[model samples]
Target: MTATSASTTSAGPAGVDVAQFADVTASDASLRRFLHGLPGVDQVGCEARAAGLGTRSIKTTAKAQALDLAIRMVDLTTLEGMDTPGKVRALASKAMRPDPADPTCPAAAAVCVYPDMVATAKDALGDSGVHVAAVATAFPSGRAALDIKLADTRDAVEAGADEIDMVIDRGAFLTGRYLQVFEEIVAVREACARPDGTAAHLKVIFETGELQTYDNVRRASWLAMMAGGDFIKTSTGKVQPAATLPVTLVMLEAVRDFRAQTGRMVGVKPAGGIRTAKDAIKYLVMVNEVVGQDWLDPDWFRFGASTLLNDLLMQRTKMTTGRYSGPDYFTLD
Candidate 1:
């Protein structure tokens, strides 16, 4: 198919325009048919491609640029049950000033927190270029009523969340209730619009680990994109197998194809398990080769991590000083 420029107003895959989700979601069979009809994923080929890309050489200046880009693309997160205002304040401070010693470092893309901490994070973040992103819609499990989920999203947006990371109802998705999941995403997307009308971007998390198959991941990626996801994320970081190279490769291909088909570019975030500067640089290499340089920007991509920052900083220090810096040198947070 010849690629057509994507307009929120135009009809999407299976003739379901984002605005017409309510109508399209009226039939369960239609939703299932649409999802299952998507192209199948070649598991071996995908994994092999990702592994090969991981071997690409990124040395000297290019490596430094990739490290900085990865640092800027991080969603510095702390989502524990024991989270407190003080904890969030400290995290937000660290996010704003990732490297107090080196003013050259860029701020993280956002500081992710629970809906209740949005205001605290916003306050702590102040006028810093960093954004406040809140996880909502019963994140991690996404097993809540539509009304409650929408309310959760609204609460965060009202509290000044510039972005919302929401998890899909994995149970519903796995049970073949595609329409229900599709409608839920549509509802959350509607809820993300602020009162003044400028809206927070919505990232739909698939938790690919639970989805259990590459085909499911591919289908979910398309489902979220068609439902108006600004970014299709890999996991919630609460799962055992949060993010991995093959899963990220699949998601990258999904976004690339979605843009090719609809002419709209959505971002991708591979949360969880990305801990080292080497790991991050590998992902950068995948993005650069798989989808080209267009998706390299922080706006178009993000890494949902906290520890990954320190590693990147350490490697960056090593690159600059010609020696590796100990973990003690970086802020603990």
Candidate 2:
């Protein structure tokens, strides 16, 4: 329950003290026992809490602040097979200046794109303070071999990605091969290391929809954190049932508890299906309540979304000018 729990003095991935989890990751059997031993989620209670939080209202000034915060939290993203360099450049531009009409609009947290597009996004975002995040490790599916996955991550980091979002092997996770998934995450985290010795922040995607149970979600959250993931993400945005409130609640709890026990903080990102200012506000409230304000900043939380930015801008405009802006006022992602 503490960082000194393990007797070994070596450090693990992500600078976690190896001794803290020496017993837990000693072998596949030990990892399975430790993960399976975690407390099971109370499905009914979790959903009820999420629904209750979703109903809380913020009005006028508070709502205005929430909208701006949501805008800043967005990972303005585009990941499609047909995505072109021009489109990525446009997205990067939008990320740096979400609302051309207003100079005060805080830039989005980052522009998320495929590995091959990282350079383009990096070029467009150029010193704007908006990070370029690339999804690697066979993103959305994660069906490739470990070597290929590491290579995918290295390519992204080499291409100037400020962050690397790698998908976990959900199949291995579901089959209870906890160590395989853990090792792969560790490998990808290592691949994120840059020549300057600073590593690109690593976000491990769970694709929670495929994991099929709240318990598995909790286990995966702990597993990724133990393996040195800077962030534990809810989905790759390519799967159905992505980023549900209850699932995110479970993950938030995991990070809170992990920090309590290990003194290391891990971020949570709920990607996909969050499309409105109201939805983003609900998540903000949840993060405040479930993990405290420590995770409220863009550095600690993110909305992996495309359309969500437009809604935040619209709400922000309504608050500032007392009128609704048409969707045409914003560029469609």
TM-score leader: 2
> Which TM-score value belongs to model 1?
0.93
Deviation of model 2 at 232, angstroms: 0.6
Clashes of each: 0, 1
| Residue 68 miss distance in model 2 (angstroms) | 0.8
Can you give the lDDT of residue 204 in candidate 2? 92
Best by lDDT: 2
TM-scores of the candidates in the order shown: 0.93, 0.97
Model 1 RMSD vs true structure = 3.2
Q: 146 in model 2: Cα distance from truth in Å?
A: 1.0
Worst 10 residues of 1 by lDDT: 1-10
